[model samples]
Target chain A: MNSDHHVILRVVSKALIPVIALFGFYVQFHGDFGPGGGFQAGVIMAVAIILYSLIFGIAAAMRAITPGFVRGLAALGFLLFAGVGVWALIQGGDYLDYDALLGEEPGGHHGQHLGIMLVELGVLFAVSGSLVSIFYAFAGRVSEIRDEDW
Target chain B: MLEFILERGNYWAIIGLMMIGLYIAFAATNLIKRLVGLGLFQTSIILFYISLSRIDGGTAPILYGADLESGHGDSEGVEAVAEAGHGVADAAHSGAGELVNIYSNPLPHVLMLTAIVVGVATLAVGLAIVVRIREAYGTVESDEVQEMDLSVALAEAVDEVGETQAASGAGAI
Candidate 1:
């Protein structure tokens, strides 16, 4: 039951979604120097998409991002995190030892910074994917109830 | 008593919020309302931890320019470095330029971030399950679900009894 009306909402959402997505990326990458982080960024990213779906309808949203792809994306994101840890192990360092990721200044926190960045990327991917999938699941259940049934 | 109350006002508010959230989450019949209560409880808990970490006249938990120039790390010979850093930080704090070493614990804030993510996931999954329940049972009420379950149980029990009776009657014949 996507409202074909609400011309104002549609226009505003179209303008806002890109800016919100940019803000999400900013939060994801600038977390070390600032307050925002993967979880917050992921939620914000999901919110923008959900808002799009809210205005444009689930059919359009699904076409943009299908349910199956979303599920696979979530799994891949988790694997990316694990793979980073395993890469550390293969590099002869402890699991998730970002120090092993590069040969920067050993005393500095360069390696740790790299590792954290990678891990946060994984977190962003998995979190956003799961949220989108959850939204898709909730939205697809239209047969569960009619609008006035409640 | 008044002094104690004033000193711990934040904590008291947090506790009050917690109790209200718990009451609605446990006592409410509607699933969505219960989830909202859970969200409220989570907000209060986050606030409570944040309050605990607040330090009066403290700045952000970041090493300032002075701190960086002085150099600080989780290194050995920490006592010497700590003494040096402390003296500089203290002097800066009292100086006209304005600097402070006092910072609220960052660990609690970091841990709470993880907790919030977990809480959100739990809420989302819980709501999804609620939706499925509505699909299956055509109702989201806990009492209605229980009643449906009871009827299903009663029917199974009656079926079992009928099978035993038929078996016994055939054996007697």
Candidate 2:
């Protein structure tokens, strides 16, 4: 597919894909102090994958991150998020009571910070996985209509 | 009248966008067009919430004192200028003696972020369903899909009636 046409597209996208993914990670982690968060970061990361698939092909993209793996990521993320809440419950606090999860003091910021980070990480995984899988579902269909048909 | 209209220009824009979106969602025959309309409507609502969060002389919800001082050296001069400007405005508005840091409300912004995510997911699901519909009916037009469904239902009713008549005839024999 990369042999002939869209040479410029292929080259530019190849260079840009890593940079885009890096920016996604930056957004994910720096979200605590800035405007970005898990949702924005996840979408940005998913865009990198989607862009690659658009330039290369779905088959190549799937090879890098298979459907099964994507589904597992989504499930794992949900579990991670719920796990935090459940952990708080087990520690004799109300559900999602992050203060009990960490810190010696009842209302310390440490526990809250840790809880938010874990939850955001979970959201990041779930959102990115779901988006990529949705893209795959749309693109993997047989007998695609040509652009001119539209 | 002009002053009133110009002062509320952001709201006017939002209303215009919302109406356009609603019109497309109701009047468009193409399924894709309807989804596009829904997206536009969602976007307008998001814009409205963001606009509501704005304060006349407020900065972002983040604390600018410690972080700004420690992180960027150049931003100190900018921050000082902004503080000076705000001080003047504050004096004019409320006869201020103490410096007050006004920050825009962050709650609406956070809620809208979640709304935006939900909107994307909804749009994705809607488009996926539309794709399946097109595959099954070979068309994405709402009217055509309804017509095809009506025809299929009619055919099924005719078949049932024919079977009943044939059974009655066989019983008579």
Considering only chain A, what is the TM-score of each predicted structure?
Answer: 0.90, 0.93
Kindly report which residue stretches of model 2 are placed more than 4 angstroms away from their true locations once superposed. Answer: A144-150, B1-3, B66-99, B170-173
User: On a 0 to 100 scale, what is the lDDT of residue A143 in model 1?
Assistant: 73
Clashing pairs in 1: none
lDDT of 2: 0.86
Q: Backbone clash tally for model 1?
A: 0
> Which 10-residue window in model 1 chain B sums to the lowest lDDT?
B71-80
Per-residue lDDT of model 2, residues B50-107, tens digit only: 9999999999888577444443433344345446665434333333222347789899
Looking at model 2 chain B, which ten-residue stretch has the lowest summed lDDT? B90-99
C-alpha RMSD (angstroms) for model 1: 5.4
Per-residue lDDT of model 1, residues B75-145, tens digit only: 22233444566553443344333333677778888888889888888888899898879878888888889
The alpha-carbon deviation from the true structure for residue B148 of candidate 2, after best TM-score superposition, in angstroms, is: 1.0
DockQ metric for all predictions: 0.31, 0.28
For model 2, how does the per-residue alpha-carbon lDDT over A15-113 read when each residue is reduced to its tens digit? Answer: 999999999999999998888889999999999999999989899999998999998988898899999999888877889989788633422357888
How well does candidate 1 score on lDDT at residue B95? Answer: 37
